[model samples]
Target chain A: MQVYVDGIGILGPGFAGWPASRAVLAGEAPWPGGETEEPSAAILPPNERRRSSALVRWAMHVAEEAIRHADHDPRALATVFASSGGETGVLDQICRSLASPERVLSPTLFHHSVHNAAAGYWGIATGAQHSSTSLSCYDSSFGSGLLEAAAYAEVEQAPVLLVAYDLPPPPSLFPARPLTAGFAVALVLCDRPSRRNLARLKFHLEDVLRDAPDTLADPGIEALRGGNPAARALPLLTAIARRRSSGVRLDYFEEQCLSIEVSPCPP
Target chain B: MVAMTGKIMAPLWISHYTVVTALGRGLDSTFAALRARRSGLRPCDFEDAGLNTYIGRVEGLEDLPITGAELMPFDCRNNRLALLGLRQDGFEEAARAAARRYGAGRIAVILGTSTSGINETEHAYRDRDQDSGVLPAAFLTRYRYTHNTFSLAHFVRSYLGLRGPAAVISTACSSSAKVFASAARFLASGLCDAAIVGGVDSLCLTTLYGFSALDLSSAGPCCPWDEARDGLSLGEAAGFALLERIARTTDSGAVALYGYGESCDGYHMSHPHPEGLGAILAMRGALARAGIKPEAIDYINLHGTATPTNDRVEDLAVNSVFGTATPCSSTKGWTGHTLGAAGITEAVIALLCLTHGFLPETLNTTRPDPALAIRVLIENQERPLGRVLSNIFGFGGNNCSLIFGGL
Candidate 1:
């Protein structure tokens, strides 16, 4: 499948948006690593904004950035939100509540705990009635999400927004699944070529029985890519940032990967 | 901006399908229960959920743990339900047959679940050492397979020996219904030649307590569309359908997915739009995608969860789309609201109605709400059915509508 990347959004440690992360991705600036700042989803109503979890904020923050970069109405685009561990904080809270003698749960927290919370909040924030889906594939979440988005864009002939985000598991569950930090990335993919196209991606599944997925050249970026599932998009993002044709492989499962041939569109 | 996608979608053959719910295993038992108007619901007797509400719990899953050395890692209520569902109606055999016909590498496994194996995680947490605050070592290795949302697809793919793309949609109740749309798109995009689309959600304390917290659980068997309706009866179910892009539909029982539509409520996280705007859009979108008039539909499987608000709102949506002409009913009264699995469960029921010339009435509903304009059938309609529409709405305002027709 092939689709044109029209816009990009990214947020992680020491980076908040596409332009802010471009230098680091292009190998022109030092990797200044630090804790990620809390994203404020002011676009949501005040009540929802207050009720929003960190994961929801991270996903919406990047989704909003991508929509702005693409200069498109958010209401018109279908959306796909992907994550491995969804709403860790909420999960921890629910587990803790269940463990208690009373086993009483907060209604708001219970409702917010669904995997589509981010997509739901996005719809409310933007009044987007377009189709939206939330999905997961563990470490392969990014590749799976990208594949779904690209396929939707091509088959439906519509622009689609794909958001992949994951936050570190709560401390109680960290030992079982240790994630380094929170990371989120969004892409607006279109079936047709446009002046806004950053690159054209041709994707197909490849069987690499023994080979590992592609890794970033920069050590800091590589660590980020390895630490979080959503950060696995670093290599593809870097290739787009460099504006050079390249082949990038993303982990899809144990023995197979998603191979993408990236051809940069002329500026 | 995105373009409106209303063009007619190519129909995909439903080669085989199977379901495991409180009703029973596979098609024959489920059909028997539906015909006899026997609900699978009973008082909550699940593993110490201790809730007052009734539940549609599958029986005997405790002794039926996934025991294979390779599959033991995925031994959980959700996967057990999936195994039970897959082993029925020759679903697994049909999957293998499709793999043989299209190559295992060209068949995708896409499933939907709201809580995939989180029951095991809850147990693991309960076993946590107090002072050390560490989970049991034995449960750590199985965490990925049991707790992660993708475990459903992973286990299904591995069990079926398929090497194709796999994913798990987790958009609450609408998850499985949306899988049909995703599979259709993937097949159209040439990513996969065949697809396994289904969902499984097991009964757990999280949902029991969570819905109790939200005051959405009914103390009795749910009576959708009833004037005295209270709330939903929670249930657990697993269902699967083998889909292939083919025109071979000579069998009388064969049904094809004609169209699917998905949308967001953009209203509230838990509460649906008072006007059912998203529901209307989804229904209209499905009709547009099928390139059929609303009057063409013979039956409507309402997403009537038995909650007063949900039933009334869904009634308004149905009235807006198909009006009172089309007879509609909520099978949730039989299976309870199966959450993520509701989509495929109800979808399979809709297919059964298409194949068998009968429309199931709302099982426990005696009197339809007088305020609602849509026709809520209280008696089963025995007649030839051609096309049917199923609706599934989930938390976070996710809504999906799927249309199925006999070929």
Candidate 2:
């Protein structure tokens, strides 16, 4: 189905919020290229240069920018916030509270503990009256949310805000990092448009086997990390925000095989 | 007539339900206890969990083993319910046989869960720190590995040696119910030969207090559809079924997903529209998709959380859609609210009605809701039903309705 991305946002290490969205535009982030867990400079809130868990930091920064970019008047568009690792740190904290006397769960932490908290908070802040969702999948978290958003757009014919991000594996809980650092990407999908026009986006679902011999090829990469990783939305958002058409295909094959196609519109 | 392309042949036999609830373990246990119609309400003695309300706790998850560090985490409440569900009615063996016959890699494992393994993460994190600024080394890695999504996909795949696409749908309470639509899409698109779609969500701190925060929890066992219907009784469960294309052989037959309607209410986050407009839209959509008349529905297993607003709104929608004569009831009184798993659990219950020809009673209701305007099955009765509908509406205005049929 064809849907227009009216807005976009980004947040994470190396940069913060919309400013951090530059990584996607440049198509590169300079790093030591090793296991030395250094977060990229494209993420938001420049203060956190050396810290880990950039995913959480980035997700928060990017979401706010998304609302602003869409000029999102929370009174309208729906939302879908996705994360593969949902509040890993919070889960760690709650488990800690369980074994103690006078189990006092933090009200602030608890409020954000639910999977939909990010979406909920976004809604609450923006005064958006539309429904919101929090989703987790086997890496396809973004794809699933996008498909659902696409369905929402096709069926309900309304604009939707989609966010995908992952915090650094809580070092206190689990550890899988280095290139796996945190980042977030957002887009506003609607049937209508408002802008210094960008390309119209169409999505198609394709299934590619994990063991497919050519999975390492371009087509496979398009089917694997191209369509909807939330983070991968960065490439599309950056390209569009910079007023460049240059097509890009994303592939996220783990949960489901899906691809997003972008073709520029004539001004 | 050229039927909907994805629509498979009708099934002659109905499926059976084997529920695992705090009301004692198996279906025989549930059914036997159900015969007497007793409520299994007991105090929740969570490991220092402060909430004092009662829960429909399923025993045995505590002793269940985790594959890695107590920190690395293994089968948690989510997986426990899955194992419990697989144990009932040779579900595992039956699923195994179906996989073997169809070829092992084709039976997709599609599950719906909330707070998948946070119970483990919650426990691990607390032990590592008290006033610490940084968490312990062990918990950070393990909690991230298990809870949200990956562990669930891996856990199910490893346990059954399942080789198909492993997916975990976490949409809060709507998770399981929505799986029906997803499975149908996959089957229709020929993505998989068959699928075993269901939901498994257990009681956890996130849900328990989340509901409490909204003041949606009733201190006593919930009274769904009753005038005194207070709130939801938190519970845990797992329910799944074998889904395949229509084959000529009249074995278990095909219980294909005939139709599903999904819509966002665009209403409130925590509450359903008082008019049930979204609920009506969903029901109507499913009916239209299935090409069936509203009056064709023999019974409806209502989402029926027993909250004042939900029961009232759902009642209005039921009356408007099927009129006041459609037989319906809320099984939540018997099973408590299983959240994400409720959709599949109730779907299994509805399927059993078609197989057994018996409409299960809405166990305890001294007085029906004065606000309710539909015909509710207060007592058990056996009736011929060609089709049935299961309704599920979750937080955030997510609305879904599923239709199943008997040949």
Best by DockQ: 1
Q: Relative to the unseen true structure, what is the C-alpha lDDT of residue B180 in candidate 2, on a scale of 0 to 100?
A: 67
Model 2 agreement with the true structure over A1-267: per-residue lDDT tens digits: 667776666654333455443543454543212221332433333433232233444554566666677675645676667777666666655555554565555545554455554544444344454445566654556655665565555544567777787664555544432125455777777766557224577654333223321122224223323322445554455456455555444334443345556765543
Candidate 2 on B1-407: residue-level lDDT in tens? 01111222232122333556766665566655555677665566655545656667777877865455442255567777777777788777877776787665665666777678776655554555556645556545554345656566556566676665556666667777877665554554444667777877877776676666566777777778888877877888877776766654544533545677655565445667778876886787678767788888888989888888888999999899899998998888877888878888788777667666767777666689776889887888886778899999876567678888864
Write down the C-alpha DockQ for each prediction.
0.68, 0.20
Model 1 achieves a DockQ score of 0.68
User: Candidate 1 lDDT, tens digit per residue, A1-267?
Assistant: 799998999999967789978888887787788988888766778888888998999998899889889988888899999999788789888888888788989999898889999999998899888899899999999999998898899988899999999998987778767888899999999999889888999875433211467877767778888889999888899889888899888877877778888999973
| Off by more than 4 A, model 1 | A205-211, B1-3, B247-250
C-alpha lDDT of residue A190 in model 1: 93
Relative to the true structure, candidate 1 reaches a TM of 0.98
- Residue-level lDDT tens digits of model 1 in B151-222: 999899888888888899999999999999999999998888899999999999999999999999888999
